[model samples]
Target: MRPQENYMVIISPGLLVQLMERTGDGRSVSVRELADAAGCHPSKIDALRNGRREKSTIDEALAIAKRLGVDLLVLWEHTGRTVPVPAEPPHIAAVPA
Candidate 1:
């Protein structure tokens, strides 16, 4: 079987709570509403908001970010062991006399 790539979307609980207070309409959105928009359960939203959880799937993060009318970076950050890039090889240029 092919190996699957696993990624964790780490969110800022404090920032999430703050953003939820002021949506695009300048009104607060409920947990249930946000959950519906995020295609998850209200408890999940509550857990994240209350700092009971910190990690989420990419889809949930995107949906929450979209509903909040902000970029994904605003609320979540992608952190993990990065694959290092190999050093570039030397390029030889031929010069004409």
Candidate 2:
């Protein structure tokens, strides 16, 4: 296999807490302030921060990244993707018998 083909950057969820903590250079931004800036609800931010929620939408993630003055991709851990997501997500075809 070609080396280039083997290179894949997979970004997972759950980096919100770190990003929030790092937003102010270790000072950390308030949930309300972050929520206002990132265009997401404070409760959602709290959820992510406290691990009440497992993941966040890409828009929210990008917003947090933008507010933090960092690249969104940096927030995610690089795990090699063994399976690629489809361009068009597959819809459930049936409930099964």
Candidate 3:
């Protein structure tokens, strides 16, 4: 018998929406602008916000995070429940494995 592979799911649309809302004030940015910044289509961003898209590329997420001025890991933590940054700045470190 073959064993089923265990997959680790990371990030969620709700969390993404939360981060976006937090940074964008629900209108701080438009879908078109987010798409342009993320190098993706507006529909993709819409889908992500609406919970239709579950998987996201690291580059895409990073770009969005950069645009939002939020830490990539902070957003990841919002979805994955994993803290990738420390409480302090300048000496920020990844959560120990």
lDDT of each prediction vs. the true structure? 0.74, 0.57, 0.62
Clashing pairs for model 1 are none
Deviation from native of the Cα of residue 68 in model 1, angstroms: 0.7
Deviation of model 2 at 8, angstroms: 16
Q: TM-score winner between 1 and 3, please give it.
A: 1
Q: Mind sharing the TM-score for model 1?
A: 0.73
Better of 1 and 2 by TM-score: 1
Tens-digit lDDT track for model 2 on 1-97? Answer: 5343221122433466666666646667778988888797898778656654534555666677678777867763322364442221134123446
Write down the worst ten-residue block by lDDT for model 3. 83-92
User: Which 10-residue window in model 2 sums to the lowest lDDT?
Assistant: 85-94
Candidate 2 Cα errors over 4 Å, as ranges: 1-15, 24-27, 77-97
lDDT of 1 by residue, 1-97 (tens): 6464333454568888888999866888889999999999998899788776666667888899889888888887764666222222234123546
State the lDDT of candidate 3 residue by residue for 1-97, as single tens digits.
6563222223666766666665744446677887899898998789777755544567787778777677776654332335232222333234756
Clashes of 1: 0
Q: Considering every candidate listed, which one attains the maximal lDDT? A: 1
Model 3 spans with C-alpha error above 4 angstroms: 1-10, 22-27, 77-97
